[model samples]
Target: MPAKVGAVKVNNVGNSSVFNIGDVYSMSPESTAKTYAGGGSFITGDGIRIRLGQSTTYVTDKDKLDQNIT
Candidate 1:
């Protein structure tokens, strides 16, 4: 019904983030990131050259009700 907060301090808040000091119904944070790195190359038998690269994906939420789909 009521909330009381004393001295508070915050350092930082990132994108798609939430900071609650009091009561709340709900909170959802979503984020997606992709990265790639390569240091080598390869050639196919058909004489086609291809570069090899490593990749990674990070997702906070695959499906969020706030956005419907992710």
Candidate 2:
């Protein structure tokens, strides 16, 4: 029952208790809302894959991408 507004969720495809997973909505899985598919560019759901947007690399002591996320 931990629902968050404007929270992005991956579809619980196989979960018998899952709601929806292809877009964005203002309410929780039980509420009436639509998914946000970047016009066939992105998909969110369990087992479903998506190409994430380009990542930005900041200058660290090393040239590797920062692994520490807050």
Candidate 3:
């Protein structure tokens, strides 16, 4: 059996490249990994943003996937 823990946030922007998940997350516009379409905005309560036209690829690759073994 596997127990679910924590939460994940997915960004559906077009070209943005910012993804954040967990209890507490924060990012500044100047230090953002990629540039957003219109502008970067924070997600309510989650303290994350993916910009206007960015998309999330959090776990699309197997080599970079984060697996939990308990």
Clashes of each: 0, 5, 7
Reference-based lDDT, each prediction: 0.64, 0.47, 0.46
Q: Runs in model 2 with CA error above 4 Å?
A: 1-4, 20-70
How well does candidate 3 match the true structure, expressed as C-alpha RMSD? Answer: 17.6
lDDT of each residue in 1-70, candidate 1, tens digit only = 8799999999998777889998888887777654343343222376565644664444465654443435
Which of candidates 1 and 3 reaches a greater lDDT?
Answer: 1
The candidate maximizing TM-score is 1
Please give each candidate's TM-score. Answer: 0.44, 0.15, 0.18
lDDT top scorer: 1
Please identify model 1 stretches exceeding 4 Å from their true place.
37-70
lDDT of 2 by residue, 1-70 (tens): 4445576766446532455544555643332333333443454577875555664444345644334333
How good is model 2 by TM-score?
Answer: 0.15
lDDT of 1: 0.64
List all candidate RMSDs to the true structure.
11.3, 17.1, 17.6
Expressed as tens digits, the lDDT of each residue in 23-53 for candidate 3 is 4446643322333333344345665655456
Error of 3 at 59 (Å): 40
